[model samples]
Target: MENTHGYIPSALLAGGIAGTSVDVALFPLDTVKTRLQSAQGFWKAGGFHGIYSGLGSAALGSAPTAALFFLTYESVKHFAGSETHWSPVVHMCAASSGEVGACLIRVPVEVVKQRAQANRYMSSLQVLKNTVAAEGFSGLYRGYISTVIREIPFSFIQFPVWEYLKKTWSEYQKSEVEPWQSSVCGAIAGCTAAGITTPLDVAKTRIMLAEKDSLLSRGSIRYALTVVHKEKGVRGFFSGILPRMMWISIGGAIFLGVYDKVKKTVSKYYLKKHDHIT
Candidate 1:
């Protein structure tokens, strides 16, 4: 059996690499999604131009945020005996906890990233400086609550589905899943989650990209959603659904695939080294 101690380091490194890889690789898609969801409309929000505008902040934040999330998620699973039972509830809880922890870093990053993506700022640093100067330090965390609200539900759906799919495949095949299989499972789960939770995502994007001092910028999820509904109707809630689903689907595949591959490799190496010492 693998030692529990090995999981921590594996989770950290694998999560970091996976996060950075997916974010940097799919940043253009994410930028398009952000712009599509922007209140200013697509063309006004830079409309496919500067698709890589926020790549720096996304790259910088992805590693740490993903690392923190997986660290929390794996720790919770290990402690909760998820390896033995692998309950969906446990997966949901672990994913939720991971989202909560990850969002601390993620929200600030998203604020800069989405703003840059919308062409409001030329660079991550510029966005950061202007936001702080205008809205104070709290500006960096503009959509913290809304983001958590969006992410938790997304995790509630995605992680449980991913775990269940992997488990089912493993049972059917009578072997552990390949990283590519995990990627497929992750893509399915992410796409499903993205489609269902699009309204919440739009709400988060609206809150983050809202003008300073605007009602939307006040960060009330309900009010922001209400305003969106009032302005654009139900369709507004799904503004970026296509790009969102596409980005997340591809992103999930790369993210989870890389994570599984790196974590397994690192864990196996660590176990072998440990056995040698013994």
Candidate 2:
């Protein structure tokens, strides 16, 4: 097995590919999720095209966000690894760190995307211009805290489960060559995490797309929660859970499957180079 403690360009490359793949593939579902979670109902939010309103920006941002996240995640995990392997704590921390870094890019994309999903923007560029004009640069990061609250617990749960599944599969099969196994692991991990964090996600969407005078306007997390509950009852907390879960389950599988494939390819390329040297 290749040592997991070394700097590997392939890890960075694979992560970018994985991140972009999932985000793009899942962007439509993500739009649907954001729309359902919005204060505005679906018809007011427009039809099929509205669901993909900010895809241009989403596609543009996906690669870099994914790249940064994977690069940070892989590097941190490797550096934190012991002679043998990383402990569970190391995996969690690395995932969190990677996510935090990726969030820098993700938040802006989300702001634009969610606004579009809510029918708040005529176009992505208009979203940026208007946000800047009204709320300044900071407006683009409307749901920063809520996003972190949602994402951290998600990574904490998702990565550990994913890692455990990968290890189990490898140990039983005596090989790590199974990309489909990684996909299944990813799907399970993502579904569990997405379900748990649905409330936080709802709040984040509300905060980001809320109008100045609306009940869902930018406010405290508790206020947002109370507002959603008051309006939609307990079911409000899970408005977008359906599309979100589908997006996450399939997206996770695709993301991990691609990452594993690229990592394996990179490992083989280096191994071949080393053999030639010897």
**Per-residue lDDT for 1-278 in model 2, tens only?**
44453236777778778877888788888887877887777667864665678887788888788788878877887777722455678878988998898899999988887786677447888887888898889888777877877788899998888988888788898986488889999999999988998998888888888875565556467889998899999999999899998999999899988988887778678777777888
Error of 1 at 84 (Å): 4.8
Mind giving the per-residue lDDT tens digits that candidate 1 earns over 1-278?
33465899999999999999999999988888888888889899898777789888999999999999999999998888776665788889999999999999999999999999998448999998899999999999998999999999999999999999998999999888999999999999999999999999999999999888898898898998898899899999898899899999999999999999999998988888898999
Using all chains and alpha carbons, the TM-scores for the candidates as numbered come to 0.97, 0.92
Which parts of model 2 have CA positions greater than 4 angstroms off? 4-7, 82-86, 212-219, 274-278
TM-score of 2: 0.92
Q: What stretches of model 1 exceed 4 Å from their correct place? A: 1-5, 84-86
Clashes of each: 0, 0
* Candidate 2, position 128, lDDT: 78
Best model per TM-score: 1
Q: Residue 49 CA error for candidate 1 (Å)?
A: 1.2
